[model samples]
Target: MNKDSLNTDYLWFLIIKSLIMKNVDLIFNEKQESTLFGYVMKETENKDKIWFWVTIAMTFFIMLLFALPTIIIDPYFHYHEPLTDYGYTFYRQRYSNDGIVRHFDYDAYIVGTSMTENFKASEASEIFGYNFIKVPYSGGYYKELDHLIKRSFSSDNDIKMVIRCLDYTLLARDKDAEHEEKDTLHPQFKAPEYMVNANPFDDIKYVLNKTILFNETYSTYLNIRNEVPTTNFDSYSNWCSAFTFGRETVLGEYTHTDDVQPEKEFTQDDYEMIKGNVEQNVIATINEHPDTTFYLFFSPYSICYWDTAHSNGTVKWNIEAERTAIELLLECPNAKLYSFTNDFDLTCNLDNYKDQVHYGEWVNSDILVRMKNGENMLTKENYKEYLDEIEEFYSNYDYSTFAVGNEEQ
Candidate 1:
C-alpha cells in the first residue's frame, strides 16, 4: 500500500497490459486480410449487417421484457379491477396468436367511464340474466362511450345490451379538458373506423401512455395487487370484501368499499369539455342505436361532500345536461333514464360519500339495488333499510351542506 511500492506495481501492470494489447493489435491486423474478417467488415458496413441486426433484435427483446408483461400479463391477471381504480393510461387491448382480441363471451356490455368500470359484470349478469362484460375507459365522456360501444359490438354479434353510466360532473362543457383517445395496437390489428378517425392529439397521447412510456415509469406490482378476476357474483363479492369491513362471505362480484376518492379539483376547462363531450355523445349513441335500450343513471356521490360543497350552478348545469341527455334518449324510443338523482334520497348526500364524490359501502349497495331494479326507483325507505343493515355506517360521516339545489355543500 506504500506509494513507492504501488507505483512499481502499477508500472508492471501497465507493461503487461501493453504487451497484451500489442499482441491483440497484431492479431487484428492479420485478420483484416482474412476472408471471414473481410466479409464481416463488409457486412458491418451494410445496414443489414448481422451485428446491426442483432442490436436491433436485442433492443426489441429488452423492450418486450419490460413492456409485454406490463400490458398483457398484468392486465390479464387484474382485468377484474375497476376501471376507475387504475389510471386511464393503463388501458390496453392484448393480441392473440392469431391477432384477435380475446374477450369474455358476454351477451351484454357496460360502456361508460370509470363509474361503470367498477361495476362487476357478473353482478349485471345476475340482475339482467345475461353475461355482462365492461368495455370502459377513463373519463367515460359520451362520445368515447359511443365509440367503444361501436367497437365492442362490431367485434362480436352476440352482444345484446349496452349499460352506460352518466354523472352530473361528466357533463361540464369545459373546452380545455384534455382527453386521451388512442388505440395503441391499431397498427397490429384492424380497428374500427372511428378509431382511425379520432383526433390525432388524443391518439398520440394514448399510444405514449399505453405503450411507450406509461408502464416503464409507473409501479405495476402495486396496481396488480388491487385488481383481480371477476368472473362471477361470488368472486366479485370476494374481491370487494377483501377491501371492506369484517369477515363476510362475498355473495356478489363487486367489492363493497368506499375507498376511491377524486381529490383533484376540476379545471374550468375540464368542466366544459366533459359536459360538451357527454352531451354530444349521448345524442349520437341514441341516433346510431335507435333500437338499443339505453339505461342511464347518474351514479350517486358522497352526501356530505355534495351537500356541503356543490352549489346551485353545479346542480343546474348537471340537471340541464341530464335533461339534454334525456332528450337524446327520447329519440332512441327504447331509452329510459333511471335517474338516481331523484330516486336515491341520499343521491345528494355528501357525508355518506368516502371522499369529495365517492359513496360509502351501504350507499353503493343501494345503487346496486336500483340497477337491479331497472324500471322502478328504490324508495328512500328501502335505501334506508340497507343502511340499517350496515348499522350507522354513515354515522361518522362529515356533516356538510351540499348546495345541490341552491348552494355549494
Candidate 2:
C-alpha cells in the first residue's frame, strides 16, 4: 500500500475508536471500575478493535481484488506483452496504441486520425514487404500522433516506413489544440498520462480505473476463460461496415447554411500556428529519421466541404496552409507526399462518401494502390500544378447542380 492508503486506514481507525469510546467518561471511571459499566466498556472497546481490524482487512482485500486484473492481464499492455495463454483484443486505439507501438513487432506503422483506420495491416505488408501495424487515433491532434511515432522509433524494433494521412481540414488549427474533450461532453475518454509517459507513479489512476479494469481487463480475462477468439488485426478498428454508405446518407449528414459563417483573416498568428504544426509535429519527425520513408497523403474531403470553406471565406487561407505543409514536407528527402484533390470525379460525387469527409473502405484500399503505383504523387515540379488545378476546380464548381446518384457504393 502507498502512503495515501496508510493514511486512510489510520484515519479510519481513529474515527472508529472515537465512536466506540464516546460514552466512557473519566468522571465515573474510578467508581465504576468494578461495576457493570466498566465491564461493558471493556467488552465494547475490545469489540470495536476487532471490527476496526476486520474493516481494514476487507478494505485491502477489495483493493487487491479490484487492482489485480489490471496489473496481471494489462489489456493495454502497459508494462509487458500479453501472456501467451491469454487472448487479447486490439480495440480502443487511443488507450492501447501506446502499448502496441512500444511492444508490438513491426517495421512500419500507419498513423493518423479516423481517416486512416480502414487501411489494413495485411494489405500494407503485402505492398511494402515490411511488417505493418495500423495505429489510428480518431479525432487526434498532430502532437499525440508524432509522439506515438517517436515512441515507435525509440523502441527496440527498427521502423522502415510510416504511412499517414494529413487531413486538410485540420491544417489551420493551433499546434497544441486538442479536441480530446471539446469534441464531446464527456471528458473521461481522454488519454491517460500514465500510459503516455514513462512515469510509474501516476499509474495509480490507470490501475484503479473502473473503465480500464472492467471494460478492458476483466473483459479480456472473460474472453480467455470462455475460449473466445481474439480480434483480427486487419479489421481491428475498421468501422466501415457499421453504417450505410450512399449519396443520401452522405448529404443527410451534410449541413449547409446561408447564415454568415465566421470570416476572419489569416493573421501572422495563423501563419505561425500552421507553421509550428507542420515543423514540430510533421517535419521534425521526418528530419530525425532520414532512413525511414514517410508516405504522407492528404485525405480527400468531398467538394461540399470545399464549397462550405469557400462560403465561409476560409478556402484561400485553408489552401495556403495545406500548400505550405506540402511544400515543407516535400523538402525532406525521406518524405513522399500524395494528393487526391485533383480527382474531381471522386470528390464531386457525394455517393462516394458516408459523410462530407470520410470515404468508404474501397477508397482506403484505392489510396494504397495509387500510392504504390506513384499515381498523383506531389513532386516539387507538379505540386504547384496540382494546387492550382484543385483551387480552380473547387472555387468554380456548382455544388447545387452536383448529381447524387448511387454510383460508387
Candidate 3:
C-alpha cells in the first residue's frame, strides 16, 4: 500500500516466472506470467536483483492476504456497514460500540453508563417514532460518550433525538481529567484509538488484529454456515436478561460499611466544575446540532444508594448539582430534561433494581413510557419544587433495612 515502494502486482508476476525460470521446464502455461517475467529479467544479469524483487513480491502478497478478511468482514464496522446478509455476534461492547455508532442505521440512540443498559431500543423506538440504537458504556465518562456522539453527527445519519442519562455523582468530578478510558472496571478492554479517530497510519492495529481475525471474521463465517449463534442488533447490549430484580437481590450486592464517610456540602467551586463539565462535553454537542433533540434524564439510583450517600454527607451536594445541570439543559430549546433521580416509587422500591444504580428492564420500560407521557419532566417553572421534593425523600429515607444479609441486597 505504500506508494513509494515498487508496485506489488507487478512484482508477483516476476516472482513466479523467475522461480520457474530456475528449471524453465516447470512452466505453468501462461503468456501473462511469461511477459511479466521477461520485463523484470530483461537486460538484468545480477542474481541479487532478481531475488530482491521476489522477496518484495512475497511480502506484499502475504500482507494482503492477512489484511483482506478484516477489510471485507470489518468486525468492528470500522470500514463499512455490516454486510446486510452477514450475521454477527454483538456481545463485546467496547469493541463494537464505535462501529455501531458510526455505521448502524438509526435516527435516535440511547447513550449512558451501565445505568442505561436495561433500556429496550425497540420500545423506545416505538414511543419516540424513530429508530433507536443503544450505545452503553458500563463505566463510561462524559468525555468518552461525547466523543462517540460527535462521531455520530459527523456521519450521514439523519439523527433526530439523543437520549442520554446524567449521572448525579459524575456532576462533581474534575472538568477534564476524571475519565477512565483505560482504567475502567474491565481494564482488559478499551476502545482502540485507531477506530476512534480518523488516522489511517495506525490502522495496522485494526487490519491485522487477532480478535478481528479469529473471533470476528471466523465467527461470521460460522454464522453463514449456521454453526454459531448470532445476535439481534437492536438488543445488542441489553443486560436486563442476565440479572433478576428484587429487594433481596439489590441489597445482596451492597456491603454495609461503618466508616461513617465524611459528608461535604456542594460549594460554589463544585457548581463551576459541573458547569464546565457539561458545557464542554454535553452542551457543546447540543449547540452544534440544534436539529437533534436531546432527551436528558438524571438516572434514579435506588434509595439505598442515596442513603449511603446521605450518610457520607453528599446527598444534597449531588441533588444541587443535578438541579444545576437541569437548569443548563432547559435553556437549550431542543433539550428536554427529566429528573427521575427522585422518583420515589422507582427509587424507593428495591424490587425495581438489581443493584444501587442499575434498574430492571421493566423499570427501563416504565421510564420510556414516562418520558413518552412527559411524567417526571422538569420545566423551568417546577424544577425547584420537584428537586426539593426528591432531596427530602432521598436525604431522609430509611436505609437500615437494606443492610447486608438482606436477600439479593
Best by TM-score: 3
TM-score of 1: 0.51
Model 1 agreement with the true structure over 1-409: per-residue lDDT tens digits: 5786456446544644565455443333324645443446554546356556655765665444444434443333222232334422233422110111123456666665545545666666777787765555545455545555655544544655666777666566442333454444555543233132324444323222343333322334344465632234222212233343211211122232333333334455554555467546665555666556666676755443333323222333343444444444444555555555443456434344334454444544455567666644333334334324222333333333221232332
**Candidates ranked by lDDT:** 2, 3, 1
lDDT of each: 0.45, 0.78, 0.76
Candidate 3: what lDDT?
0.76
Best by lDDT: 2
- RMSD to the true structure for each prediction, in A, is 13.9, 8.9, 6.9
Error of 1 at 179 (Å): 3.4
| C-alpha TM-score for every candidate | 0.51, 0.80, 0.85
Candidate 2: misplaced stretches above 4 Å? Answer: 1-65, 182-189, 257-266, 402-409
C-alpha positional error of residue 370 in candidate 2 after TM-score superposition, expressed in Å: 1.1
